[model samples]
Target: MLTHTPEMPHALQQLLDREAAITTLALPRRSFLKLAGATAGTGLVLGAFPPPAGAQAAAAGLKPTQQPSAFVQIATNGDVTVTINRLEFGQGVQTGLPMILAEELDADWSLVRSRNGSSDPAYLDPLFGLHMTGGSNSIKNSYTQYRELGARARAMLLSAAAQRWNVDVATLRTRAGEVIAADGRKLGYGALAEAAMALPVPEQVRLKDPKDFRLIGRPTTRLDARAKSSGRQDFGIDTRLPGQLTAVVAHPPVFGARLRSLDDSAARAIKGVKAVLRIPGDLGGEGVAVVADGYWPARQGREALKLDWDASSVEKVDSEKLLTQYRELANQPGARAFDADMAPLATAPRQIEAEFIFPYLAHAPMEPLNCTVRLGKDRAELWVGTQCPGLDAAAAAGVLGLKPEQVTMQVQMAGGGFGRRFVGSSDYVVEACHIAKAARAAGLDAPIRTLWSREDDIKGGYYRPMHLHRARIGFDERGNVLAWDHVLVGQSITTGTVFGQFMVKNGIDGTATEGLRDPYPVPMRLTVHHPKVNVPVLWWRSVGSTHTAYVMETLLDEIARATKQDPVAYRLRLIGDKHPRHRAALQLAVDKSGYGKKQLTAGRAWGVAVHESFSTVVAYVVEASVKDGQPVLNRVTAGVHCNLAINPRSIEAQVQGAALMGLSMCLPGAAITLKDGVVEQSNFGDFAVPRITDMPQIAVHIVPSAEPPTGMGEPGLPPLAPAFANAIARLTGKPLRELPFKLA
Candidate 1:
């Protein structure tokens, strides 16, 4: 179990205190009529009604209210609104979660609607107790919670129908949002919603078995597809207000640099420029905000400003120098992740010494970071696409010197996050708040929307840490491992943050060591060195598994090839029978891809790899052929074991999306490098991302299981590059160690 620090930052402590106070509010029991009307509109409107007086006192001795109406609402028009507790940043949770609830509620699929929930205590993640939407845990964590909510809602509806008909509740059954009595009488859920709201909430309700499920494992289209495709969807960057001013900041060229002198004469003279105010930035840096009527004017004004930066005190990091330092550190032992006797290494007949390098990567979601903050005398509202709304709200409150309760966070849809939006530092959110505060102080009294340009976002810090891995392995002629000594050097992502207190142990950040030694047991001595680098690092899509999987899977494949064994057969032998999921996923991919039976086209070879991340297993069978000195992925067949697919279409989409992102790692210019503490890449022109031409023909297959579902968002990504690399190695007859695949 992960424990929060006993002494938290002032902002975080205040947020927790606010959550505690919310848990103590005694909610009055309401009649069905009141509850129905309350949720009949867009969705359940939170904070619209006040708690009863002395409610806190009552809540001290009693359990807080568990109202089904808080999550489900039935309109008179037969529309069923389900509030999703996670941010819908292209993961399809808006549709996937609603499918789970509607499956149990027996609601009409066409009439079912979903909405993003705000930062309310009722929407806290059941497992983490925080309002977060990462780790691909949206479906896994909330599966049971949403199911129970639906069951309870259905039970209440049945009770109401039975009472209205003056019959026993057991004599009626629900189907498509209607209660059908045994005597041929039926009532739509809408007609009895008010009555249902008046009924006492059931403590327990029966859930449908997997065999009886109509939606859980079905392939359903995303509910937001039409809106998003038609350009009708409103993301955080699209937020607008009556008098909102678009703001863009002129940050220092280097991270944590301070502003020494500013000449804003030309900037203030620009048309539509509202205010130019200097504000504090992330990591003790200072920046100047340019507020104008629109983004164009704000950007124009920002470009006109002249400023000198003072970076004399900060460390200036060079990517090449950092890698050299990391390699040196990897040669020496530091923190011990695993310990085993290396006596066999000295006398072993065969040995392989290998070194791998991975460069820093930026998240670079489609939509850049933006936050719209509206400040009032004592109240503030923020519109942003944040994975952790509770923390963002609290950070906003702290920035504005207000109580947590005074801040309202309207969670907005995001184009994509890929772990960028959920930083422990909350840098972007806090930066927006700071700009809003400074704008208000400068007499620009309207909502301030701080936007990040594609350049700004690409150059912005918080990247995946660059890593260097050195491994010395001793094995027999038959490829039986005798000893393995490995060393990893990288900056710890959690070292000085809130998560570090729990995730870092004895100087080892657990995230850095994940997916290192698993499935295949090996006598390994592993040491890690975490250097405090100047570059800011955060979790990429799959966190450490992104690199760890590549190392493990590719190295195992190498060992198999060294012993003249089939990679698939070798993996199956090593996996043995202990890990059935890994075996099953790999076998399925192999079978579906016709790995052993089908002959590939000339110059194309088969590659296979499997990895588990976020509790889900993903295996890839790829066809690769080098063209013009570049690896081209012809096709990818994926075998996924997420336990049970809530929506097969969503699963397929996630796999396809993740696979493409993985392929991006193999393209040139994918890495984020630095020269003199300044990021070298600023936009897509330099920082390469996979385009349409780079995408391969991907086919996704899910393993059949009635067990609860796991996450599919990130597991599909970790194995893609490694599998592609394995195929390329077969072609070139040389192992590829670095990212972007240097063929030479």
Candidate 2:
């Protein structure tokens, strides 16, 4: 705002490799130009616009998904390359989605390859109609769409084969990229692909039954494994162009601080320095961009510049003071989210009052945020790793004084986003476009690469909102909740953005209250407070689940402990039959972890936590011990129920990665604090993340089902910290409330 810097363990690294390193193709900026109905610079834009020409064709009856030319490319040698719609940023969708398509296409696994898609109309999410890759919706939302794409392509191939053989289409069958006639004659898909494109796309094509699937649910190795592991993978930061100049922005230390004065005399004297530009910053403030022949000189030039900032216009957000303010706000009435009877809270057999404090968190992806923009007379092209490609393109066009149709956003495989690259503001992209425009005006007229160093990424404003949760609960001795009143105070992540209309309702942001209640059928009255703060905030990985899941799971575990009932039994009884996915996941984790049947090592204790986020449910059973006064996680067993498994290995790897990310929240030095409106932490040394040495032995077990797939990218994270904390609480005999656990 955006790898152990959101870097990863070995298993997690595999998922990341598969996500970013698409096999066998060094796709060019216009590699997707041949995509059916996918003309460069012509896709959906931010607000309202006339249907793009490509979209108009779809409206005229050629559904883009049904067009084989858009998704499938059968090379003359029987190799099939599939274009993935979503940005592959370590969720493994770059491979997992292709497995779904290739399964139906009957393509030979060894010859299958993948590449990233453009911000084309056909590449939009089939359900949401947006160029987005968040919410773990890559597989969940596009499963059927991609399947139908493969089915249509296969059908077309069969038709072409049948026409050539002078036989009925039904008389031919497909097997391993070949069409087989009833008489045993075989024609490879590559042989018939050109003719297949001439045939009309079928309006309806049948998908394969789950029982007949070959590629899915199998622990197959990723096709791009070799490329990424060999350090040959190229992220957006690696973009290089002829006569390209690198730019570094000298930002204000305070959020939204305007540039008061600048002295660039020494900066201009640097050998490689070309021009210095004053441009709009991430916020509405001003920042200076130093342009040079390369990154080293750009960085040096920026370091040499003398600048003064005016921060009086923006509020100085002090974390400690904000905490006090939030506590006071929590004491007052707020906009209602859940309105339940709280009469019983006044008098009950047992009562528990708790206040949880969570500080701002950074999405510090290993590869820092960067964007490269090349501008011509009337058009602009961008190379970036972004979650909102279309929006970014539209924003770029706006900044470049061109129409949306004149800008091309060449989507690149990101190193890791974790919501850092999906900013509603298009902050970094906008900065790059402005830099490009300013450079061209200064007679540079060359592509400009705007790079954010680790320090810039760390101190950048957009962060997971600091939240304060106050809960007063009154329950009977049986641990049955009678009345619970809860209040949450945090900045709204989608307040003024395009997503605010839906994400924010009445006056409360739904993100802050997403996982709070209803899962347990608890009688809870919830109130939310969205305070105006100078610190910019955005979604971080699991978003609100970062804190909500912790509160719910830990409180539930405390209730179970207070009632002297088994935690699992209590949760099961509370969950009941209404939520089978949660029950299945929890039971699987309990069974696989040997929770009750096997005794743990002498100092180790067990912790169990289950939560549902992004429609997928994950349960974690963990073993932990206090070593030298620090809580050390020993082992973890997870049971995930995300419906059907696309790739078991990918799911396992994703869970392992997400579990580590979740564990990071509990590690000391994980929080991002502010003193007088400036971020205090800058790098991994100060802002800690989990490395392999800190990771626990994790085993991910997926619950078998064929109810289609749900999100896997984020569900694994919510349950982790809670489970670990529950184990620590058992050993300490006190419930833990805050993150980055303080034993004192």
Q: Candidate 1: list runs displaced more than 4 Å.
A: 1-66
Assess the local accuracy of residue 587 in candidate 2 as a C-alpha lDDT between 0 and 100.
95
Question: Clashing residue pairs in candidate 2, if any?
Answer: 3-6, 3-7, 3-366, 4-7, 4-8
Error at 664, model 2, angstroms:
0.6
Over 593-656, each residue of candidate 2 has an lDDT whose tens digit, in order, gives: 8999998899999999999999899999999999888889999999989899889888888899
lDDT of each: 0.85, 0.85
Against the true structure, candidate 2 reaches a TM-score of 0.93
Best by TM-score: 1
